[model samples]
Target chain A: MFGFCADPDTLGNVAWMACYLTTGKHMAIYLSVGTVLLLLAITAPAALAFGFAGASAARSRILPLSWLGRGYIAVVRGVPDIAFFLFFVIALDQFFEWIRHEVKCPDWDQPIRQGNDFVVCAEAKLPLGNAAQWVHETYGFFLAVLTFAIVFGAFAANVLYGAMRAVPRAQMETAEAYGMSPRQCYWRILVPQMWVYALPGLSNLWMVLIKATPLLFLLGVEDIVYWARELGGAKTARFTDYPHGDWRMWYFLALLVFYLLFTRVSEIVLDRIMKRLTHGQATSGGEAQRKAA
Target chain B: MSCLQTIADYGLRSIGIGERLLPREDFTLCQQFTLIGSGMIWNVYFGLIALLTGFFLATAVALGKASSNPLARKPSEWFIFVFRGSPLFIQFFFAYFAFLSLKSVSPIFDPFTSAWLGAAIVLFLNTAAYSGEIFYGALLSIPKGDTEAADAYGFSGLTKFRKITWPTMLRLAWPAYTNEAIFLFHATTLVYFSGFPAWRQKGDALYYANYFADKTFNPFVPYPILAGYFILVTLVIITVFGLVNRRLNRHLPQESRGRLKMRMNLIR
Candidate 1:
């Protein structure tokens, strides 16, 4: 914020706009975009890890593990993801808090669920009741990221499962002919080759994951959507530095353009990545590139 | 009240036919089930209507995009890109505000502020763009032999399309289109969550589920009920689409007709 922003009311239109955009709240709102990016950064790898585990579990020789993996993948088959986002935030929160309640409040006797209220002991509250405000927000964001990771992990698993199966049987057989164990074949041959198949699905999933970041607001994180609504509302003359009528439409429009640009950039980047990954592979994409060369 | 009476009262509550006020306390499983089931009507309404209406628009847009004409192709391409690129959630919010802003200038645009019309239009356009892209891809893939055969029969333009090109496109696009419909249904949950306000507490299944979750502070129960309802709905869509897929592929040789497997990874 510039020093001239000290008296925003008298500034010209351009100066006022500059001061308005650089307000502390606006800075927080700008940082909320980072919150979204950070969420995507965090959730992408977490979901991939979860997906890898789920895919491996499904492909396992053990019956129970396979069933559990299959169940996890099937969880997304029916329900809308927003439901899971909403459900898991509470369900996961309670599960953790309830665990803490058991450990931290062994002497407490009251039921955790008292009719309508979920009255966990004070000590069991996430981030502890006495913790700083930022700690509570961080806890919420962690839960939301976990929720995103869990839900999208199922989708990633579904994609990875197909990619794993799509790895031609001949490839795996040849690896076996070399006397490599199943595990070695899986890691060396199948895993490396699966990326070519998975890239398309994974790229699409990445797009979905990017789009889903807005739902972080519903999880109570002060993400872009939250900030947009907060900052873009009609600000009365007396209440704020610069008075503005309903500017939510403009705010949302900005978000729309931001998303459009993000997706466009992602598409270009992913296309290049796809080309890079497909090289020397046996898939159609690879086959075409070989022919082109 | 008995479960039967409660159902009779709250069964149509989502549509505002019965039960002026939702249950405040001591929520029963029956009430959660009934209300959430009632709320499902909105989901079905939004999904079916959007898909049906979008079908025609998608067909046109697909053709337009496939056209060699720059004028027709450019707008069609841009429409698809804009809708397909961004999040539907943001689209709803942005569209709602856009419509709200319009309410001042033109009285005719007043009703666009409501969820039923405003949100439905966004969902409809959103789906059309997606399906259009799918259809356009399928359209391009229609075997040259088939079109050559149509030309040999002295058929051209719309005649060739209605009889030959259209059926093949639908058949080819059917599997992906099924996935599109599934995602569209899942997307209807965002309507209430976005800027569109649910009038008189009337909302889709997720809305009622969220409500019960908030009130009872026990999300484990209601959300699962919502999920169960959705799973059934997904099955119904798949079955209906599967039958149509069969009819479209009726002329194809037996082995060539790919079975309709519900693949989970759909572009949202």
Candidate 2:
């Protein structure tokens, strides 16, 4: 915000619009955009780590680990991700609480699921029942982040699995012939060569991850979608100083345009990165660039 | 009541045919299956109708995007870009609000505010944009020799497109299009969860799944049921699409045929 004359009603249309945009709630909306970007920044790497583990496990020498990894990937693929969003937030919370309850409330005899309520001991409650509001909010956000990481991790695993397979056999064989162990071959040769194959799928996943941030509202993170609904609703003089009719359509339109621009910019940037990654590589893209050069 | 009785009572409950009220207490596995199974009708309806209708628009859009004329190309390009670029969740909310605004202007648009029509229209446009891009890629890849042979046979314009171009595009695009169909069906779950209200509790599978989850406070049962239903449908989709892929690629020799690999990683 800009400093202006303090009187709200006396402001002209231009000043009113400026004040409306700078209001506390609007500031929250702006901050929520950071929350989305933060989520992407955090979830992308975390999911990639999870994906690498899953992909490795799926390709493991041990049969059960491979089955477990493959099952995790397959489960998420079949279900609509929003279902997982809704389910995992609660399920994971309950799971954590159950662990806590087991340790903290060992003497308690009552079942945790009593009819409909999940009755964890107060000590087992996430963020504690008496915790500050921000604590609760942070806990919810943490759960959302984890939920996203797990679901998207499965997708990433699928991509990475394919990419790993796509690394030319001769490359791995060359690593083996040079007296490298299997682990060394995996890290030194196989992983390095898989990036070009994985980039297209990973970029697409990044876009999906970007698009999925709005579902943070469904997970109760007070993200942009939540703010859009909150601020854009019909406000009467009884509610606030800046009374206006429902402007949700305009707000949503703004969100749409934001996403469009974001995706378009990302597409351009990803294309550049893809080109850079493909340079001197064996893929078709590299061949094309080689021909052009 | 028995599972059979539960099925009888709530089998068509999603369409408001049988049960007047959803089970309020003591949730059973049968109830979860029946109610959620009942709700699959809507998902099937939305996905099938959208894919069927979107096919034609997608073809037109693909051709338009590939056209040499800027007048024809620009709009199609932007249409595909706008729809493909944004989240379908936002699209649902934005479309619902737009429909609500339109409904205020004229009662003729009243029905558009509901999930059945408004959501379907959004899904239709969204899938059309995606499938359009796929078809456009296929169109670009249509062999030069195939078209040259058509030209030699004096085929041009609509006749050439109908005879040689369109079928080849479909064949080439079929695998990607199959994935799009699966994605669309998965997306139908977002309808009720978004801005659109499920009128009188008539909603798709996820809606009932959410309802049961809310009531039972045990997500393990209902969500898995929903996932099972979805997996079954996904298999059916893959099978049906595989059949179509087979038919389209029938003219090719056995080994040269493109198999329908469900690369579910491409898009949501």
Q: Give the candidate number with the greatest lDDT.
A: 2
Q: How many residue pairs clash in each candidate?
A: 0, 0
Q: What docking class should model 2 receive? A: medium
The alpha-carbon deviation from the true structure for residue B127 of candidate 2, after best TM-score superposition, in angstroms, is 0.4
**TM-score of candidate 2 on Cα atoms, chains taken together:** 0.97
DockQ values per model: 0.70, 0.68
- For model 2, how does the per-residue alpha-carbon lDDT over B1-268 read when each residue is reduced to its tens digit? 9999999999999888987889999998899999999999999999998999999999999999999999999999999999999999899999999989888899999999988899999999999999999999999999999999999999999999898999999999999999899888888899898899988898899999999999989999999999999889999999999999999999999999999987764224
Question: TM-score of chain A for candidate 1?
Answer: 0.97
The Cα RMSD in angstroms, rounded to one decimal, for candidate 2 relative to the true structure is: 1.5
Write one digit per residue (lDDT tens) for candidate 1, span A1-293: 99999888789989889889998999998898999899999999999999999998999899999999999998765578889899999999999999999999999988888998998888888889789999999999999999998988988888899899999999999999999999999999999889888888889999988888889989999899998999889999888878898899999999999999998999999999989998998878889999999
Docking level of model 1: medium
Fill in the DockQ of model 2: 0.68
TM-score of chain B of each: 0.98, 0.98
